[model samples]
Target: MNDMKELRILADACFSAQVGQALKRFNASHPEIQAVVSIAGAKDCLQQLKTGDVYDLAILADSGVAAAMMPDHTDGYYVFAGNSMVLAYAPGKILNAKNWREKLSDPKVSISHLEPNAHSVGYAALMACMLADSVAPGMSCTLLNHPGRKVVAADAEVTDYAFAYRTECIAKKISYASLPDTMDLSNPAFNAHYSTAKHDLTGDGKNIVQASAISHAVTIPLAAKEPEAARDFIEIFLEHNFTAQGFQPRSEIVGKSPRRIHAALEVRKPPRVQSANYEDEADVHLLQRARLLHRQQPAAEAG
Candidate 1:
């Protein structure tokens, strides 16, 4: 590999800015390697990869990775970062956090969400809404009619609220309410609860089941033009970039023959549960309602 070669990365839009910033710093320090990043929705990014669009590295949500894995497009992959869904809003627009559920239920307050199938955040948003509705029946219905839009656009507007990533809200300096672990889909302890809510994609009738947590997975594709550079970037990224940007970094490496390891590494399976005992009576009720709802209607019709 040449010392001055450039590396191309295709990443999900949610964290691309932060990733670009990290790569800029890496480029400055290393001088020999320059990296450029392209950001898009998770679905779009994965589709590009599937169609033989060349990139040295790819970063996307776990769901997207799952899709990529099916086609053997990934040489290796690992969970690098974790994030949770939140309700982002402009300052002073909604008062009284205690009445958030009521506010969301009120038809007077307009809400925005992302397309459920196109993006992980969108799918998580639907799960969050369904979780909210389970706590108080009919809460999800209020958001059902709300049109889906990009999170960036939603953040810029002064709408009542929009479903978004907590890290994104923080990075963009937007006011947001952190949802509970059970609803946010960011805690492994709530896997049982999270799995209860599900929604179907718009085009395909495939149901998007909620995972225990929202994670960012990075992979080096088999046909990468600069595999060595991709490995170097991953090493620098996992060691320094992710934690600085408010992501919970994983210490383990995954997939067959992971790239350079700066420290002792282990290949661990995705977390199925967390030790935290955060579930309360309300959580129990929420899960109960979710299971009941799932049984009551088909996923396609429910969506």
Candidate 2:
């Protein structure tokens, strides 16, 4: 008897919407292969691999992190998209300010992000701060860290601003302001500027992870149970246009000669998607939605 085929994809929260959309398209084209997606912080996703957790594929925001896994945890990978960091602020917080810098430098304004050690965006925020500190001396803003989904929630209590992916702001329709290209970690042209900002994720005096232009990549682990299925998922993911999500194409970022280490996706007619249930639809919505507010739980009060 033929065993059931399944593809499990793990991705950074920033790519949640794109991965979700790709999975849905994969399902429609190849209903026989079961595909699923899980979202986590970039570091946490890579940590799972380091701990021997085998996933069919992992799409990470940081290309450097994925490169470190090469030939050991994963055999191959490719950059599919690029993104930039933006300052997402609460309504009426920065509306009257001259620019994002002025708002961020204001003593009364507060800033927040996910924990730097666990989340890629958090580390990006730290790097942004370091870069900002260089430009505006003695800038003191109240900085906070939320260990969970608190900072990205719809009702997030960010009094002034929070660091977030540009895609998140676009997907959720949140008001945001762009930082200088160097501070945003977006343009490859500012690679030299980006190099100046760095952080030691492990809190050790070593293994410093430097800031680089944010590029998203997908890789199949060496221990992946369904490598072929993983390739099929990647094919589907590449076929989709994510411009609406504020993502730049891989070709745009890396140049015209894109790398395809594996053989090109075989062209074939796609099978019609079968009818889906409410649960299936719900899963699609959950992944496609950028906000994590729905997953948040209210804090318990003291008895």
Candidate 3:
């Protein structure tokens, strides 16, 4: 009875590869805990927590998710990992990225993100708001009004954690390109602009509690067979081995990294989110624009 048992893990696909490696390492080191992992989006993970059903661990894209859940739940939570938002662009857009940036000063950029209600999307929404009003104000309307942002309303899971580059650019699919994870901070690029790679706004957040400027997100959740065990998982995430294994450590990657994809880019965090009101972040405008696209099939007749 002393040994931990029946561990359920819910996490975003972003950690799919990393978590598997972590668990393999965990099992070799500690065999007492039995863990089962489910690949869920950030919003799904949140739903798992709120329903009060049954789950041992739930890893998510943004700490804001846990913060929003227990507005008072701050004490027990922790930031296990850190990531930046990637301002992905369609292939065509990247072709003339600099021009696009200039055009994006308005809504012409045609930005896309996970549903706003999802944990990751919640954060992306915050970024969208900032992008729209930051430099010249209403600049992001280029992306926002592209007709693609409308389909999939909230794609938090896709934004913050999807392991692949294309998922974030799900809307303008068939073909796309992105900047590597080590995005440039000084002069940000548009292709796949991640948050950690974005530059800071200067003298705005450094005084508060370190800069969370990067657009990408990190996952945090009050998860575990016992919340304490979940807390221990966070501790492990922050441990040296997690970083040594090439997994981005919270310290080196978190507020510490000077990741700024584009000079004009700014990072965003979520306020509070609930998956119940989740929307789709599908590429509504990707029909002929490209090959892949989102679709809502008709409910089959009661045949």
Which candidate number maximizes TM-score? 1
- After superposition, the stretches of candidate 1 with alpha carbons farther than 4 Å from their true spots are 1-5, 29-33, 95-97, 145-156, 199-202, 206-210, 241-245, 249-253, 262-303
What lDDT score belongs to each candidate, Candidate 1 first? Answer: 0.65, 0.65, 0.38
What stretches of model 2 exceed 4 Å from their correct place? 95-98, 137-156, 205-207, 252-303
lDDT by residue for model 2 over 145-212, one digit each (tens)? 22222334324465567788777777777777665554567777557667887888777854478888
Count of clashing pairs, candidate 1 = 0
Error of 1 at 120 (Å): 2.4
Question: Cα miss at 199, model 1 (Å)?
Answer: 4.6
Candidate 3: where is the Cα deviation over 4 Å? 1-4, 71-74, 90-97, 102-111, 119-126, 148-232, 239-303
Candidate 1, residues 27-70: lDDT per residue as tens digits? Answer: 87767767889888766776678778888888776544544454
True-structure lDDT of candidate 1: 0.65
* True lDDT of residue 129, candidate 2: 67
Model 3, range 31-63, lDDT digits (tens) per residue?
676556788665566556666646555555555
